[model samples]
Target: MSESSESTIESGGIGLSEDALRTLKLVADDEPIPDDDPGLRDLRALHAVVPNTHRPGHWILLDPQQTAHNLLWRGIEEVTGILDRLTHVPKITEALTVEHERGRWRDGVGSEYIEHADQINARLDQIMASATEELLTAQPRKRSKSLLTMALPRDSALLERGCKMRTLYPYSARVGVHEPKWMREMAKRGAAVRTLSIPFPRMIIVDRRHAFIEDLVFDSSPPHSGWYVTDRPVVEWMSMIFDLYWTRADPWSEPLDQAGRLTNPIQRSILRELVAGLDQKQIANRLQISEKTLSNHLTDLRTKLRFKTTYQVVHWWATAAENSSALELRDGEPFPNFPGTEGP
Candidate 1:
């Protein structure tokens, strides 16, 4: 072979035979292969075969039976045995080596380890012993008696430690007679309680530092699975959510007002609209009164309350009406004669 032909054969492997090499050179030189060329067919056939060379420096390949015996059963058993034996061996050997090298100081090092461990234990004990604060938790359904009973004491203890408590219950709990009574008792002890159609995730945050949340799937069992104790951003987030709900909640102190006697139907209607957070236009629409009449009533309210702006009028009305019973007129009773009765 010529020097160039030998070089081509070495570089291109099986496809570098004289005729095939010539065809490939023509293709490389931008000449398309002609349909009638036998060299082109040979080159194409060689190119179609896949090269299965192993990666560099790794030529290990076992037969199927050998692979199964080595990798599946024997290899795993061997690896596990080695790991088990070596689990403590490395540390033990390292310690022995260190002791041999520094005999007298080894005792000091061991004492240092004990001292650090004691410090860690003391810190953890302090955290555990610190009186926990009030906590509010929500569960989707009634938990086991034992679980709830345990929680109740913790809750009471927290409350006794000057922590304010609140709890949310699913609406289903409201249907249970016992549940409401239990909630009422909790309320009497200064804990706020509310019921929602569906109470969200079961969560408890203690003193805004520690939180326990459900991490497992909801299951009804003793080891009522799905409990996770965390002390991080989760606690902060849950505390904020609890405070938001607490602010909007109607406290048990505000008993339902049953007194309904209307001195002025129009004024009471306007007051209701104001408390409902409606704009003047909306109030007029609902009351079937014109915008001008609504404005006139608002002006009268402002003047009567000695207020300067419309906002002041609203604030005065809301403050005055918040605790008052809703206005009502007895059957066949005449509308209470007020100064503004002349208007439509």
Candidate 2:
């Protein structure tokens, strides 16, 4: 056979190998081939040859072209059936999804516990890739440089697709070296970045439909285990929380603008915690700042105000003009009035 013909035969044209074709050809010429040959079994399987009943151990070869035609016709039918099934896959998947979601509203809510960092990242990527409306994230603590690096492209793509992105970070994050750069880059890409002095729960909300939050069971650890929430009520509540903080937050444009005020929001938060009877370490932990950084703020306050002790600072903060109003951290929740201040 020519090279092209052999190529066709090898490509399942007739579902017969070259060896089988050769065996068939030999049988057609009445050549005495071995009865136990492997090609003989293949030729028989393809119906390309039949046993000669009158001549024991002899075979009869059918027309190769006819055998090829029959085999190709059957293959074509199988392929057509597969194509028909392939066309139904998307519709079938959609129907199954609808069925799975049936009565889910009455079932209260749906949540998944993602137990690992990689899985959480993958799920977020999947969710963000299809997000159309907005993404709201509250990161109370500073993010690692590596995590920020990995998220830049994914976030930029979300912004490029016209998704409104807003992120909330603690005031301490603004002083970080790498995080500020990441925040600035994101802000430049039309993302609304803000910082709050008050501590808030970390969460990510996509399109106001889904939310991801820390498990709180592992909040003291470094792993990224978390909960994926799809309940409309729960997600809406988280979104509301984010909006409340965002309302009181300062924008990324002015990182350290005092506005002629003596203390920044972060310093005010430290003072607030101090007046609430928290020690230096506890205040630092709550504000997501290091103890050293917290001490620096105190030292700066003491030096600027010409005071010698933290007690003096707290004394002044209680009677300060700014602490008079109720500090609203959440809906209907406000800080209690200090000793020298009046309630709202």
TM-scores, all candidates, are: 0.34, 0.62
lDDT of 2 by residue, 137-232 (tens): 999988889999999999999999999999999888888868889988999999999888888889999999989998764333346778888989
**What's the CA error at residue 86 for candidate 2, in Å?**
59
- lDDT against the true structure, per candidate, is 0.52, 0.81
- TM-score of decoy 1: 0.34
The total of clashing pairs for model 1 equals: 0
Clashing pairs in 2: none
Off by over 4 Å in 1: 1-129, 144-146, 216-223, 227-231, 245-344
Could you list the CA RMSD of all candidates, in the order they appear?
A: 21.9, 17.5
User: Which candidate has the top score in lDDT?
Assistant: 2
